[model samples]
Target: MKTLFSLFIALLFSMVAMAKDTDTRYYEMRIYYCHPGKLPDLLTRFRNHTTKIFERHGMTNVGYWVPVDNKDNALYYVLSYPSKEARDASWKAFGSDPEWKTVATESEKNGKIVAKVVSVFMNLTDFSPAVKAQAKNPERVFELRTYTAAPDKLNDLLSRFRNHTFKLFKKHGMTNVAYWTTIEKDGAQPKLVYILAHKSEEAGKASFEAFRKDMKWVKARDESEKNGKLTEKVESMYMTPTDFSTIK
Candidate 1:
């Protein structure tokens, strides 16, 4: 009886050690811009084979999307891995897999599908909600935004969002999806990226307008800017989730 009890305790410790915190997970945001008329090929490949192959190699498919307007020649998707090292290993295995090699060769028989690929690895911030699929209540439109921090003000910007901005956004009818900081490497400035869900494009605009004018928001913004500006530039893109996207 004593030995059995000791073994149970050791097993519990092993289980605890194996459980990884969600914050330690590494996520990849990849955008693939297709050749002139090859977007269909790329989409078909991902839908039929690529996503499954990624899973076989231990990568998590978060969501996929495309722009809602013209020049919709790009695919945006995110994948999660246990860690940065795990991500590298999975990609290496995926690239060399026999099935993937065959699929890539057959798919490009028409022509090279993708013209450019942009990939950034990121980690979710401390105060951000966990990344998961949300129900499509009334079919929300998602806005992807990126901010380039001014000088040394990234932490200040993150703090403001953690404490005030996201809350006001919710109060005005915007759902904060996820927030992340791009893992800087080789002298890259780590950018802040996030997504907000809205009922519609017009609704998102109205919510932002109201949020900006609210007295509490105005005071918070003024106080944060006393030292200096938080960000030098902000970029935004509105997107609708692809039919296969788990988030939808």
Candidate 2:
């Protein structure tokens, strides 16, 4: 009996240690540009000054996007980190880099490139199965999805999502790793898009199975169908994180 109890205790300790090591923090940076036309300029600055600088110091760039809907006026991007400490330290160093300073100054020389920008932070919810289930196996199989809503349908679309679809997602194990919306800074149209970190392409594909069966999802679908369509339509794209990119 004594030996069996000791073995059980040791197993429990091993499980606890493993759980602690799997804690990952994903950062979703939603950068809404004020001027859509200045996007080219902003991208150049991002590549040279911001993203490149972070990569030099070690930050992972996970995904990036610009709205395909004509109603959207801003751009969006995402990054992830092993922990918030890594994020803060790497950004601190990158922010203080002399080369980055030079790039920033030069980037702005042409004009006031960005009129305004807003950022929000979010954590993967505890109930997220992708985040929780993937803890046991750290395999690279996740993809990010972004949905851009039409200008007029933005509020209604988000309402249906928050009130209806989100619960369905949880039920189906469509683990939402991070989520947020964009705020108007300059020329940006009001819009919302969210990113989900799937474990594998197959897992991501299979999520629709549960989603399709969930009664709540069906109800939500019916309600949207009744609303004569809340979104202007949706644009979706699949992406994988660049190895060693700063947005990760």
Candidate 3:
């Protein structure tokens, strides 16, 4: 009986260790505009108002982007936290804050700032190795990718990329990851947005080499490509989170 109990404790420890290996916190937002041409105005407002509102409430801005080239017309951003509870509570308070309400209302006087928005919550999978203890600090090198897919191909593309490639990435030390797709809505083009965290630009450059060489990812990507058109187009950008000066 003692031996059996020892085995059970050992198994539990293994599971806990594996969980820590991939533990990461991520938050995603999709900001859909009333018109594509209005992006410049909206971005200015976001930089001036929205980011400050979030910071006051405890959210750490991870990265932000506008569509440089893509079918989807939206401004997507990512934020990170120590846990989901904090994310939920912070947003809840921010939403009700008088300051945020006033700013959001005032920003749209010229025109509608956002026609719609979507929020998604996710955690990194168990295979991802932890980032160095230091990368947990607020400032780090990161990039955001928004891969827009045709409605018909959305599910298949998600299954391949999210379930397959993402898992493989975690095993290769791509930790503290965040990924999500926009909720289906009229005029809303579906997109998969994810943030990649790295210690430096050089680290980001080198880390992907491992993922690129993964045999399973290569085969799966090729298979998806051959099966049919999985993506109409992909829009990706490398961006750093805004600093105090940029936000100001």
Whose lDDT is greatest here? 1
- Superposed on all Cα atoms, the candidates' RMSDs to the truth, in angstroms, are 5.5, 9.4, 7.2
Each candidate structure's count of clashing pairs: 0, 14, 1
> What are the lDDT scores of the predictions, listed in order?
0.89, 0.60, 0.64
Q: Which segments of model 3 are wrong by more than 4 Å? A: 1-26, 34-36, 70-73, 81-86, 128-248
- Per-residue error for 199 in candidate 2, Å, reads 15
| Tens digit per residue, CA lDDT, model 2, 1-248 | 99999999999999998688553574547566646467667766666567766667876564555543424345566666666688788879987999988887887786776766766554443333332212323343334444556556666776787777777776676656555454345755545555554566577668867788878788887887674666664545444433323333
Better of 2 and 3 by TM-score: 2
Error of 3 at 93 (Å): 1.2
**Estimated TM-score per prediction?**
0.89, 0.52, 0.50
Error at 8, model 1, angstroms? 25
True lDDT of residue 195, candidate 1: 87
lDDT of 1 by residue, 1-248 (tens): 99999999999988786565446889999999998889878888988999999999999999888887739599999999998899999999999999999999999987899989999889898777889877676377899999999988899999999999989999999988899999988967789999888999899999999998999999999999998889999998999887777776
